[model samples]
Target: MSEKRKLAFSKANYLIMIAGIIVLAIGFIIMTLDSEPYGFGFLGLTLGPIVVMLGFAIEFVAIFYKPKSKSDTE
Candidate 1:
């Protein structure tokens, strides 16, 4: 039988995705920790959103990033 084609993401991609998810979760947590009324504190109003955007950027990069194979490096 012919070998099945592998999926796009390699191990590094998976790792990056997991890290992105963790970052995203931390962003949510940071937002929740805000003390100002209606979550208007720094963590919520600024830092949290920035972190979330960073996480999303990471995820997007991970999805598009392709590792070089030995043959490709030649």
Candidate 2:
């Protein structure tokens, strides 16, 4: 008899999730780089939010992405 096995997500999925988290961290760091008072400079006011949103988008994609099975590809 063979034992049945399954995983919630693949290694690739976790790698993507890690990348997204790294992106999010970079976005926050970019915001902190702003020299303006209260972080009102272009990085904080515009680039930061955009980057954060992109990070979130990446996270969303990573969470939903499904890798094709070896059999499927064949």
Candidate 3:
């Protein structure tokens, strides 16, 4: 059996990941600032980690998953 090749990430994917990180940072800052309870800031606190984790999951999927080549179907 032949070995399969790994997929490589595109430049756009990296840019998206970077943007996600920036958004996550902003969310964290908003969450940490003094603010009223049960408000937008509190929402940020809940959303920040979820957004960051989603970003990482997207990156992981991009890096590890690929469609099989036509030749591989034989």
Candidate 4:
């Protein structure tokens, strides 16, 4: 891959990681702030973080977790 391609991939990976952290934080805040143990608002709050984490996980798989081809090793 070219240098530009590597840089672009790195940028995307960081963006996904940051997004995941933000989502997890939001979820934690919502879950903590709720008066009720379980409610729609609380559920909604949790969903944001869950989706963020999933996005991060998917990005991670696409980036750092992929199996390397023979060309990649060379």
Candidate with top lDDT is 1
lDDT of 2 at 71: 97
Candidate 1 vs 4: which has more lDDT: 1
lDDT of 1: 0.93
Candidates by lDDT, descending order = 1, 2, 3, 4
- Top candidate (TM-score): 1
Colliding pairs, model 3: none
Q: Could you give candidate 1's per-residue lDDT for residues 1-74 as a string of tens digits? A: 69998876899999999999999999999999999999999999999999999999999988988888899978
The better-scoring model by TM-score among 2 and 3 is 2
Whole-model Cα lDDT of every candidate shown, in order: 0.93, 0.93, 0.62, 0.59
lDDT of predicted model 2: 0.93
Q: Residues 3-72, candidate 2: write the lDDT tens digits.
A: 8686788888999999999999999999999999999999999999899999999999999999998899
Q: How many Å off is the CA of 73 in candidate 4? A: 19
Candidate 4 whole-model C-alpha lDDT, 0 to 1 = 0.59
Taking the tens digit of each residue's C-alpha lDDT, what string does model 4 give over 1-74?
Answer: 56553353555566666776666676666555656556456445666457656666765654673434579877
Looking at candidate 4, what is the lDDT of residue 31?
57
- Sequence-dependent TM-score of model 4: 0.44
C-alpha root-mean-square deviation, each candidate: 1.1, 1.8, 6.1, 6.6
Each model's number of backbone clashes? 0, 0, 0, 0
Residue 11 error for model 2, in Å?
0.6
